[model samples]
Target: MVLGWRRRKNNNHKGVKQNVEVIVPNHFMCPISLDLMKDPVTLSTGITYDRQNVEKWFDEGNCTCPVTYQIVRNLDMTPNHSLRILTQDWCVENKQHGVERIPTPRIPVSRFDVAELLIQVKASARGLDQYGCLELVHKMKRLGNEMERNKRCIVENGAPGALASAFDAFANDSIERNVNVLEEILSALNWMFPLKLEAHKYLGSKASLTCMVWFLKQQGLSGKEKSIVTLKELLSFGDEKHVEALSEIEGVCELLVEFINKRISPTITKASMRVVWYLVSSSSPCSDKMKLAFVELDLVSSLLDILIESEKSLCEKALAIFESLCSIEQGREKGYSNYLTVPLLVKKILRVSALTTEYCISSIWKMCKLGEKDDEKRVIVEAFHVGAFQKILLVLQVGCGDKIKEKATELLKLMNPYRAHLECIDSDYKNLKRSF
Candidate 1:
């Protein structure tokens, strides 16, 4: 593409150097990426684009040609062989200008090929040797990694359910001998997002839950994070018995708490938090006991640490769990014991999203009371010191739901009596606009 060159002198006349000016022919560039096309393919709209760029555009729910602005009659693309040859020739001619010839792209794998592979995988899961099964899964992963089309093909052919059953099959065998294959399957499954699996076979049983807990215990295992993510997905379709079974599992709660305390990547953090929230927020009686168990494992302090620097979504999840915990006496006691609890809630009052702000206010409300007793005075002083009054007043000014307004009003009443003893100004209350 850089067939032109120029010459210029150094600033101090140290040397004369050739400066190559790179120019790509208009037809050689993809309209979407504005770069020389590596794999030029023509759409049905008679527009040429880089294969990867256009494929990505289609994957994002686009039904019209980006350049033509017309409905795409055909999703298939025809290779622009002439333009590709010209581009490759230009690259070779401009070798000194740092242009590299693009390699020929591979054709996408067919659904029939993926279907055949899934059949082999399912067969291997039933009776193949451990090494054989592992190799097949690695092949699937390689195919998945090679191209997006192959991954979609594999998933559309039911890779998720097959893989889940395969994992369950291996779990039923000698786990110590089949751990390697299990980890490989988990690694492959991790790349396949939005998994659609038969929940009853994957996680509805006690044995499956036990197998998952074993994976969670493998501290040095490569698939621990993936296992948690998979577990969270399964819980979406799980039921009350499943929740109870998780609580009955030995050390499951502790492992979950330890996982949270590790502060791994935010994705894994949110996944693990969601799993806990699902369990603790359930209507089952074990939910209360699980809340107490988490509190005992120092879950409150871990959540506080998450709240201090987490993003909006993860912060909302952490706050949801925090709110669930505060619904109990032991949880509130543990929260009050942590020095950072109230101040962090006050800091996040109006700063995060409305849902997050509601969680914060609800949590703070649960931890405080209205009486003028010594204990109440202590909590009121803490809230006043942290500027809770001003934040709640701001919440009212900014306009909130009736429930939030009611809580804010009650919070204001709690702190108003102690304002004289605290740092609040008279104008802070006098200049207030009551939107409620």
Candidate 2:
């Protein structure tokens, strides 16, 4: 309760009344919180509640009005301007009573407004100057960033599709001159993901696909990282036809590999690797084309380099990519040809994480099992040489999933014959090293 002076008129004159407590009118308080309504809004049920309280009610999944308990037919909360005015007036009258006046809340952007902005975006795409176009995008981005509801409304109204289409158009014309505008468009679209179905189709277009490849090619470009991450998100949307089209694009996977090899930033590297893995693993008959592309680019060598230097998270991603590569014959040959292959795979077992251990052990099995007899024996000998036998034994002893356990047991069986030879070799080396 606030303290204030109350005015009482005598028979002939008015006089000040001191130290009177003021009571807030009941209607001014929220039904839920019993606090004064800061932003009053009336529901379809003809009941007025504080905007915050009503929105919280809806967010909690309540279908009925809090007071009436009747199903709300329409969820729109119309702002009660008159009630707000009165509430503000009351606050002014009680200023000395420590009452604070509520300021008017900013209205959320409506779908119609978003649609109008998108229309302007389309028009800008046609013939507007690059500066003008960029200004519009910046405006749209500002709107999206203003409030969560505004962002949701903007996304729900096809911002992604509009931005993607504009980017595609610019890409088809001349990207060299429109680089800044295109980058801004990409940045705008990045905020709109996970994109709606229509936006996915837009990004999936040939022009958009080519644009993404161009972005990825420009190392150290301002928006290149965003492009990489956006491309990965697009691929993850699981459109088979789009995945196929992307895989068929020349140098797409290769560029991704090159980006990963750069290790410019951990985020960019991880996102690029995810894109590579998804494209090859996506249901594209062009998947083989991508895998071949990756192999030709010497992706295995890059992955091994990453595995040796990376921490646990990057190790997991690199190993996953390695496992996918090893599924094919050329990849297996490439992996085995690297002397670090068996030893590195052995070292990672039961070390990084369960998933990494799985990938490592599985990759080793695939590489050794599918090669020629002589190559197989060589890999086995290398495995024993690297203490792969001892690690696999620990893997079995510590216990694991059936799949990994089977892999570990199989690896032990394959290397069993050479275990003693490996031991003797170790002893001999220990004794023969006279001068180091």
Candidate 3:
């Protein structure tokens, strides 16, 4: 796109030398982009394009050629050497015109090369050779993340199992108990985690989840974030038995709570919150174990802290964890104790997104139900004092979704006569109050 010429003084005192500007020819350009091709590759459809552009088209899951619109009966692209040679020759000829020959691009990786890498990675895992295990993993991670084809090639060639075994072996053999090498291996696996087939394979064979739990406990800050990411992916792809087992891991829940309480990166906090949510997804004992784990770790305070401070997206995640924990008595106790709990829900009502508002009210219902059920007016009294009643009245007026509105309305009915004794700020709710 940059095309210009300049004048330079002649060595022999000739007035000046003209650097002529040249225009790149249309035919010399890629058909798909109309830009001059570096590493021109001819498709099975007989159209030549820059290798990167053509590969991108196919990587987006296309089988037809872009220029001809022909079905690539076979997905093959041949290097258009003649076109490249002519283009390079033109650049050389036009050197005085500010034309620089494009350097030859590196050849794209072949599946054969990927398969060879897996062999070496597997051998390293088996202790056949270990000199460059970290380097090999780095190479595989870069190539795999480069494109869908490379990722598919690596995962399809048993790289996942190799990675899991390498991690387990490293964890077992650490003399200094160092996790630096482990961090590099995990960064690769973390990128395309939750691979369903690999999940079943490693979760069943290597006791990978337990290994991850250990890593979470042992790793430094960087490693801890990566570990949480890996564990969440593992739990997401794991089966019923895997969840049953993970729910029972002694410190897993506490570790997640710690991540939340420490206010680690939002990525880590949300990921940890998700794993806790999954553990509590199942019924009693399994669910109960995770619930107590949250309360025992003082998770309610952490959840409330994040719920108000974070971005809307993350606030929703924190609220989701609160929703699950609030179902248990211990969860309710923690929610009731936190000064921010009732008032936070009060503030979020009709104030945040529809989903957050739903979680907010649900937590309130669970906590305030203690008041509703035990005829204990203390919570109802506190909610009224905290402006929770005003927000609930506002929920009745706004279009906060059916279930949330209904819950808010019913909560009002339950506290019918008292009406929390607070002024309804929203005019719409004042009119709606007659119906309530």
Q: Report lDDT per candidate.
A: 0.79, 0.81, 0.71
Candidate rank order under lDDT: 2, 1, 3
Question: Model 2: residues >4 Å from true position, as ranges?
Answer: 1-29, 32-38, 86-101, 126-133, 218-220, 247-254, 384-406, 416-436
Q: What's the lDDT of the predicted structure labeled candidate 3?
A: 0.71
Candidate 1 lDDT, 1-436, residue by residue in tens: 3423343435456565656576767888889988889989999889999989999999899999999899996887888989999989988987766778888787677777878887888898899467888988988888888888888888888887788788878878766778888878877777766666463456546666777788888735456787788778767665777788878989888888877777666666778899999898999889999999998887887888777766898789889999999888888887777767777788788778999888888887777752226645666678788888988888889988998788778888989987776784322222322122
lDDT of 2 by residue, 1-436 (tens): 3423354434445465445466788777788778888888899999999988888888889999999999998988899889889988998988766677878777778889999998988888887467778999999888888777788888888888888878878877787888888889988887777987777877888878877778778635557788888888898988878888787677777678877877777778889888888877766677777787898899888888777767898889889888888878889889878877877787788778989988988888887788788877888888788778887888888888898788889989999988665662221121221111
lDDT of 2: 0.81
Clashes of each: 0, 0, 0
Clashing pairs in 1: none
Clashing pairs in 2: none
Which candidate achieves the best TM-score against the true structure? Answer: 3
Query: What are the RMSD figures for all models against the true structure?
Result: 6.8, 7.0, 6.2
Worst 10 residues of 2 by lDDT: 427-436
